[model samples]
Every structure is written in C-alpha cells, then in structure tokens.
Target: MNYDVFNGDADGIIALLQWRFADPLETQLVTGVKRDIKLVEQVEVQAGDELAIFDVSMEKNMSALEQALAQGAHVFYADHHRSGTIPSHGNLDAHIDLDANTCTALIVDKLLKGRFHTWAITAAYGDNLIAKADELADKAGLDAGQKAQLKELGTLINYNGYGSKVDDLHFHPADLYQALKQYVSPFDAIADNASPYYQLQSAYQQDMNAAQAVPAVHESSKLKLFVLPNNAASRRISGVYGNWLANQNPDSAHAVLTENADGTYTVSLRAPLSNKQGAVAVCGQFSMGGGREAAAGINALSKDDLAAFIDAVETYYA
Candidate 1:
C-alpha cells in the first residue's frame, strides 16, 4: 500500500495535491488535526510500500521514519520545519527547506518546475506567508481581484484546520482535501458555488466575528495576549485569530489562548510580522511547544504556566 502522511493544514494538503497532480498515485492518506504531527507512525510499513510525507516536522516523526526506511519502504519527505539530522539511506528522498518565508508547497513547486504554480501560491497564502505569496502572485501576473480571491480561499482553508480535534472542524482536513482535489486550479473551486471555499467563507466570518469581540487579557508594547473561553467556536478560531492579531499589529507579538476542558490552555503564538523571530524560542520553553520561528504553538499549557508564557514572550521580543 502507498501511504501519504501530511499535516492537515493547507500547506500539507496542497503539498500532496501538487505531487499527486504531477504523479498520480493511489495512496492511503494519514492526517489529523493541525497539531497532530506524528503522522508517519500511523501507517504500518512493509517492504515495497511507497510513503509520501509532507509538512510534518521530521524531528517529531523520527522514529517512525527510521522504521519505514528499515522496513524497506521508499519514502519521499518534504517540509519547511526544523528537521533533526536527516537519515542517510538510499530508500529515502528528503526535501526540506527551513526558510521562514517559504513553505512545503513552494518546495514542491520547485520540484515540478511550477507546473502547478498557482496551487503552490494558494498553499503559501494558506500558510500565512502573505508577503511571499504576494510576490509570487505578482510574478505570475495575477490581477488584484485574483490575488484577493486566492488569499481569501487560502485563509478559509487554513481556518478550517485550527480545531483541537477533527470533530471541531467545519470539514475534516482529509475530507476538505478530497473535496478540493477535483479542481486543477483554485479558481475552478471558487467558481463552483457548492465548494468548500463557500462553506468555509461563511463559517469563518461567523467565528471571526465572535473572536473579534474578545479583548486582550494582556497587552504590552512587546506582546498582546488574548484568552478565549473554551468552546468549539473558540477552538476553531484560536489560531486564525492569532494570525489576525499578528496582521493587525505587525510590530507586536501576539498569543491566543483557548481554554481547554481540563483548565489548561492551547496556545498559538505569532511573532511580529515586521520581525518574524523568537516565537519558537518563547514556546520551546514549555512542553508540547515547538514550531518554526515565525509561528509556533503549545498544544497544552497548564493554567499555572500562563504568567510565565506571557513573560517569556515579552522578554524575548523586548
């Protein structure tokens, strides 16, 4: 069996989309919530299996990756996250770029020589690489209206991936991906009124409205922090709300905390867009926290750690 393991977010799904468009394959997909990074272990590997992995961090999925290589699986891995030392094996094909401005789909775009460049651009937008996506859109000569459409589409798809579990989402990432795979171009999906884009567009507006009503629990020159009440809506809006906050105040670091049932918090941290640095550093001091420099998150932060998390963000950006 061929297994395709990827993050449930736009960058991961679109990364795989570009590959399948370039090299059509019958593969079993393994994906989960945006924070579910240990995807490589989900597949039972056997000799001669083809494994395609994307967007998930290599360091987090190292053991399963090594097992797949040892099991004689031919593995193709691509990502933009920090990867520990890559394994040395002829059966493994690894494509990793740690650049803050780039994402997995753009890496796949390079591999395919831009055969599916527009889709790659959409993924970049979805990953919140706004400036980078704009540059690519300009280079592609996409008109202003077209660029806006792509950004909105990307944001909606990304918004759908924020929930703590699959059930909290508007559409499970796997389902959303399957729903989108029919379109060779994102614009085609937009033209189809029944597409996920339309569904997500409406839903996103509702959740974003609720999130906007939430004022910052902690605000300072270096950082602003918002703690949202626990609910499916809060879970859905947490990360995207953080992204919105970061965009609104490009000079200030931002954190969006969603209260978990256990009284802990799920944290999404974004460094200032103007100076994309230290997010991972700040989050890394906590357990279940790790991500790229521009964006990072803590899957579950105890309530007691709230004060420390805030101070860490302020100190790092100070």
Candidate 2:
C-alpha cells in the first residue's frame, strides 16, 4: 500500500501536493488535526509499503518511523520541526531543515526545483513566515494585489487546520487536499469562486470576529496571553489566532490558550516575530508541547499550569 501521511496544516498539505503533482500517485492519505503529529504510528505499515510523510515532527514519530522501516517500508520524510536524531537507513529518505524562516513546502520546493513555487510561497505565508513570504513574493514578480491574495489564501487554508478534531474542521484535511489537488497553481484555486478558498475565507472571518471580542487574559511587554472559551470556533482559530497576534505585535511573544471540555487548555505559542528563537523551548517545558522555534504548541495544558506557562514565556522573551 502507498500512504501519504502529512500534517493537516498548510505546510504539510502543500508540500505533499507539490510532490504528488510532480509525480502522480494513487495513495491512501493519513492525516489528522494540526496538533496530531504522531501520525506515523497510526498506520499499520506492511513490508514493501511506501509512505511519504510531511510536516509532523520526526522526533515525535521516530519510533513509528523505525517500525515502518523495520517492516521493509520505504519512507520519505520531510519537515522543519525539531527532529531529535535522524536514522541512517536505506529505506528511509529524510529531508529536514530547522530554519525558522523556512517550512516543509519550501524544502520540497527546493527538491522540485520550483515546479510549484507559488504553492510553496503560500505555505510559507500560511506558516506565518510573513517577511520571508513577502520577500519571495517580490522575487517572484507578484504584484501587490497578487501577494495579498496569496497571503489570504494561505492564511485561510492554515486556519482550516486548527480545529481540535476533524469534526471541528470545516473540511477534513484529506478532503481539503483532494479539493486543492485539482490546481497546480494557487492562483487557479483563488480564481475559482466555488473553491475552498472562498468557503474558508467566509468561515475564517466569522471566527476571527469572535476571537477579537475576547480580551487578553494577560499582557506585558514580554508576553501577551489570551484564553478563549471552549468551543468549536475557539479550537478552530487558536493557532492562526496566535499567528495574527504575533503579527500584530512583532516584538512581544503571544500565546492563545483555548479551554478544553475537561478544563484543560490547548496552547499555541509564538515567539516574538523579531526574535523567533524560543517558542519551541518555552513550549517544550510543558507536557505535550513541541514545535519549531517560531511556533509551537501544547496539546493539553492543565489549568493549574497556565500561570507557569505564562511565566516561562515571559522569562524566555525577557
């Protein structure tokens, strides 16, 4: 069997889309919510299987990766998140870069020699590499209007991935991927008024309106924190909301915590855009927290640890 395992986010989906567009494949897709990074284990790998994985942290999925390799599966893995250690196995092909300015789609773009460069730029924008994406956009000769469209398109795709579960999302990642696979160029998707772009834009605006109404739970020069009420909308907007907050105040670290049904919180943290180096470290101090340096998250933070998490972010930025 051939499995395309990817994070449900824009980076993962676009990375895989570029690869598959260049090399058409009839494969089963394995993906989940944006935070479900341990996806490699979800698959029951068989000998001779081929798995193309993207976006999720290799460190979190290392054991499952090893299991797949041991079972004689050929695994192609690519990501930008922290990868503890890479294995040297003939059956495994890994491409990982830890640069905060680059994402998995950008790496795959390099491999594809920019066959789908526009899509890669969109992924970068979606990942919140705004300055880098803008630079690339200028280099690509995209006019101001075009750049704005791509940014909005990328942001909407990314926002669609933030839900706590597939049910919370407007469209399943796999479904979203297939919807987008029809167009090799992101512009084509945007031009099609009857596309996911339009759908997501409408949904995103509504969610953002709700989010903006919630006042900050804590704010300081070092860090600004907001705790959203538990709901589908809050879960669907947490990560992207963190990105929005970080962009709004580039010098202050931002955290968006969404209350869970069980009173725990799902935390999304973004290091100051001016210094995108400590988000992963700050989040790593908590259980179920991990990501790239610019953006990281804790899947479930106890209510009690909320204060500590805030202190950690403040200290890191201070």
Candidate 3:
C-alpha cells in the first residue's frame, strides 16, 4: 500500500498536489485539522509500503516516522518546520529546510525544477510569506493582475485550514487537495468561476466580516489583542484573522484569541511584520505552544494566563 500523510494546510496540500500531479499514484490519504501533525502514526504501513509526508514537523512525528522506517516502509518527507536530528536510514528520504523564508511547497518546486512553479508561489503566499511570494512572482515575470490572483487563491486555501477540527472547515483538506488536483495550474482554477477558489473566497469574506466587527479587547503601542466569542466561526477564523491583523498593523504585535468551550483560549500570535521575531519565543513560554519565528500559536491557553500572555508579548516587542 502507498500512504500519503500531510498537514491539512495550503502548503501541505499543494506540496502533495505538485508531487502527485507529477507522478499519479494510488495511495491512502491521511490528514487532519491544521494542528494535527501526528499523521504518520495513523497509517498502518507494512514492509514494502511507500510513504510520502509533507509540511508537518518532523519533531512532532519522529516516533511514527521511525516506526514506519523500522517496519520497512520507504519514506519521503519534506517540511520547513522545526526538526530535531534527522534520522539516517536507507529507506528514508527526508528533505527539510528551516530557512525562515522557505516552505515545503517551495522545496518540492525546487525538486520538480518548477514544473508546478505557480502552485508553489501560491503556497508561499498562503503560508504568509508575502514578500517572498511577491519576489518569486516578479522573477517569474507575472504581472500585477496575475500576482494578485495567485495571492488571493493562496490566502483562501490557507483560510480553509484554520479550524480546530475538520467540522469547522469549509472542505476537509483531503477533499480540497482532490478538488485542486483537477487543475494542472492554480490559474486554471481561478479562471473557472465554478471552482473551490470562488467558494472559499465567498466563505472567507463572510467570516472576515464577522471577525472585523469585534473590536480589540486590549490595545497598546507594542501589542493589540482581540478576544473572539466561543463558536465554530471563531475557531475557523482566528488564525487567518491574526494574519490579517499582522498585515494591517505591521509595526505592532497582535494576538487573536478564540474562546474555547473549556473556557480556555486558542491563541494565534503574530510578531510585527516589520520585525518578524520573538513570537515563537513568546508562545513557547506557554504549554501546548510553539512555532516559527514569524507566527506561533497556543493550542489551549488558560483564561487566567491571558493577561500574562499579553504582557509577555508586549515586553518582548517593547
């Protein structure tokens, strides 16, 4: 059996899409909500089975990966997230780049020699590497109109991946991958009005409208915080809303907190786009939290710690 396990975000989905589009395969797909990184353990691979993994952190899935390799499954892994020491095994091929400006899709693009270059650019945009994506788009000779299209498509696909669970998403990541795989190029999907691009765009607009109406619960020169009500919509929109906030106020750090049912908060933190640093360190101070330097998150933060989190962010950015 062949299994493709990937993170259910724009980068993961599109990275796999580029690969499968290059080499069509019969495989079992394993994915989950954006936060579910332990996908490799879910696949029951036997000797001789093939495994392809993308976009998820190797540190989080190391045990499962070791298990798959020990079970004689040949594995190909690619990602840009934090990876502890990588294992050296005859049956495993791991491609990892921790560069702040790179993502898994871009790694795949490099491997494919840009056969699906446009999709890689879209993934970059979705991952919130705005300046990086713009540079690639310009180098590719894409006009302003074309670049805008790719940016919007990338943003929408990314927006679909933020939910706490699949139930809150517009389309399961697997289904989104399948839908997008039908088009050889992302522009093809945009050209067709009947594509997931349009559906996601509409849904994203509705959620953004609701999110924007809620004013900041706290604001200061160094940090601004918004607390959203507990609901599926809040869970679905908080991450993207954080991205939006970071872009809107590039000089100040921002936090988007969605009230969880357990009275905790699912937190999304973004360092000022002007200085994309310290967010990971700030979030790392909390349990169930850690991420890249530019953006990080806390899966569930105690209500009591909310003030402390804000203070930490402010102090770091100050």
Candidate 4:
C-alpha cells in the first residue's frame, strides 16, 4: 500500500499532483484544512507500505511518524515547514527546506525539474509568493492574462482551505484534486475544464463580496475585530475577508472570527502592514501557532478566551 499525506491547499495538492505525474502510483490520500498540520497521524501504516508526506511539518507529528517508521513502513517526507529534528532511520527519506519563501510545490518542482512547471506556478501563487510565481510564469512563456488566471485559481484554491471544516470549503480538497487530475496544467484546466474552475472562482468571488458587506464588530486605533455568523458561507470567506480587511485598513490589526458548529470560534489573524508583528505573538499566548509575519490562523478558540484574546491584542498594540 502507498499512502500520501498532504495539506489540503493548492501547494499540497500541486505537490501531490507533481509526484503522481512523475511516478504514476496508486496511493491513499490523507489531508485536512490548511492549518491542520497533524495529518500524518490520521493514517495507520503497515509493514512494507510506502508513505509519502508533503507540506506538513515533521516537528508537529514526529512521534506518530516515527511510530509508523518503526512499524517497518518506508517513509518519504517533503515539506517546507519548520522541522525540529529528523529521526535517523534507514527507511526514511526527508526533503525539508525551511526557507520562508519555499513551499512544498516548489520543492516538487525542483525535484521534478519543471516537469509540471505550470502547476508549480499555481502553487507558488497560492502560497502568496507572487514574484516567484511570476518569474516561473515568465520562464514558461505565459502572458500577463494567463498568469493572472493562474494566480486567481491558486488564490481560490488556497481560500477553499480556510474554513474550519469541509462543509465550509467551496470544494473539498480531495474533490478538487480529482478535478485537477484530468487536466495537464492549471492553464489547461481553465481552458478546457471551464465549468469546475469558473464555478469555484465564481463562488469565491461571491463569498468575498458577502464578507465585504459585514460590518466590523469592534474597531479601535490599532485593532479591529470582525465577527462573522456561524454559516458555511461565512466560514468559507473568513480568511480572505480578514486579508481584505487588513489591506483595506492597513493601520489596524484585524481578527476575523467565525462561530463554529461546536460553538467555539475559528480565528483568522492578519497583522497590519504598518506593524506586521503582533498576530503571532498574541495568538501564541493563546497556544495557537502560525507564521508569515503578516498573516496566520488559529484553528479553534473557546468563547471564554475571547476577552483575554482581545485584551492581549489591545495590550500588544499599546
């Protein structure tokens, strides 16, 4: 058996696609939302099985992975996350590069040496490394219009991974992967498979427009909190909405919280461009971890901690 675990986002899916294209193999997939880093532990591996892991941090799931390795499974890991320490094992092969600008899609691109450069460019755009994507797009001889389409597709795919659950996504990552499997490149997908691509893009724009209509619940000189209803639509739009708010209000740190089915809150944090420093620090106090200096997310937070979280942000800004 071959098992492939990846993050449920454009970069992860593209990475998986590149691997599959390079070496056509039947593999079971394990994935979740963008922030779900512990996907490797969700599967049970048996002896002689092969596991290919991508886009998830080894540091976060090292123990479970080590257990699988010890059980005699051969593991191949590729990620750009912060890897703490790799276990010394003969059966394990890890390709981890932690450069902030590097994503799993680029890793696969390097490994495959541009076998699927177009897909790699889409993943880079999804990761918000637009300059890198643009460079690759130029090398691939894509025009501005084509590059914009790829970037939008990448952004839409990335946005689809924002919500707390599968219900909130425009399309489940697995289903999206199936849709991509039929097309050779993202450009080809847009050109040939117009229905799925345009359908998702249309839905994404609708969600963004809806999110723009919601008024901010609280705003001060330095911080703003945008509270969204616990609807599937709101959840789908949360991250992109938060990003829009951050860019629109560059002086105010933005936190977008959507009520979840369990009554807890799913939070998306965006540090204002002016500061770009407090979100991780504040969310860290609440035990949520993320990076990118300008953006991050917390999977869940109790309603009880809302006050403290607000206070922390206020204090940080003060």
Best by lDDT: 2
* Candidate 3 accuracy as TM-score: 0.97
Better of 2 and 3 by lDDT: 2
Q: Write one digit per residue (lDDT tens) for candidate 4, span 1-318.
A: 999898888889889999998898878888887778898889887899899998887988898899999899999999886677999999999998876556899998899999998889999888766667889899889999999999988888878877667877867787887778878778778887564678878888888887778888878987889878888788777876776676687788899998888887888888775776667667767756554445666667889988888888888878
Which ranges in model 2 have alpha carbons more than 4 Å from their true place? Answer: none
Residue runs of model 3 more than 4 Å from their true location after superposition: none
State every prediction's TM-score relative to the real structure. Answer: 0.99, 0.99, 0.97, 0.87
Better of 1 and 3 by TM-score: 1
Task: Report the C-alpha lDDT of model 2 over 38-136, residue by residue, as the tens digit.
Answer: 899999999999999999999999999999999999999999999898999999999999999999999999999999999999999999999999999
Candidate 1 lDDT over 52-136, as tens digits, reads 9999999999999999999999999999998999999999999999989999999999999999988999998888899999999
lDDT of each: 0.92, 0.93, 0.91, 0.82
lDDT of 4 at 94: 91
- Lowest summed-lDDT stretch of 10 residues in model 2? 309-318
Better of 1 and 4 by TM-score: 1
How far out, in Å, is residue 62 in model 2? 0.6
lDDT of 2 at 249: 93
Clashing pairs in 1: none
